[model samples]
Target: MPLKLYKKRYEDIIHSDLIDRKKNLKLIQLMMDMESAFSIPMIKNEAWNERNKDVIQFFQQVSNSRRL
Candidate 1:
């Protein structure tokens, strides 16, 4: 399913501050693999400490662009 967004929600942007550039990219790759390959495990795993503000921000930016 696609994501949903509201208007002028900069809180979405702020949640996505500059952090975890590389690991976030990795997360994206993992998601893609799960979508395309379907071999990925659950979103929450045993060692899933994936937290990054930049990843959040980048996703918000992409979603915001789509909204526009």
Candidate 2:
């Protein structure tokens, strides 16, 4: 999916009341951790690395905001 659409869906999930906040936060944290793991230099690919970086940064911001 396109980044813009993915972001929209992410925001929807964030705002939705269907899931427990703690669970959602944990999921986000897991996503960020997974992204971080993929970023290791030994296996990183240039083509999609920037996109992964963007996703990791986005998740970090979301996680921080949710904590506050």
Candidate 3:
């Protein structure tokens, strides 16, 4: 989902009274954790690794050869 929509959903969850307050608080905390876990540094690392796949493969091959 788009970030804006996702944020809106989060806001809705924060305000909605459908669930017990404790569960709602837990859900919010989990969502916050999820957001942090997938934040900028993690994404940048993934993108960097993707862009450097050939370099990574080269290092892996060298390491495997040394292990033989």
Candidate 2, position 49, lDDT? 56
lDDT score, candidate 1: 0.39
lDDT of each: 0.39, 0.57, 0.46
Q: Measured by TM-score, how close is model 2 to the native structure?
A: 0.40
Listing every candidate in turn, what is its Cα RMSD in Å to the true structure after a full C-alpha superposition?
13.3, 5.7, 16.4
Q: How much lDDT does candidate 2 score?
A: 0.57
Per-residue lDDT for 1-68 in model 2, tens only? Answer: 44464466566766767557664675565555545555534354665656577764664555564543
**Number of clashing pairs per prediction, in order:** 1, 0, 0
Clash pairs (backbone) in predicted model 2: none
TM-score for each candidate, following the candidate numbering: 0.28, 0.40, 0.32
Residue 36 error, candidate 1, Å? 0.6
- Pick out the ten consecutive residues of candidate 2 with the lowest summed lDDT: 33-42
The 10-residue segment of model 3 with minimum total lDDT is 59-68
Off by over 4 Å in 1: 1-19, 39-68
lDDT of 3: 0.46
Once model 2 is optimally superposed onto the true structure by TM-score, how far is the C-alpha of residue 29 displaced, in angstroms? 12
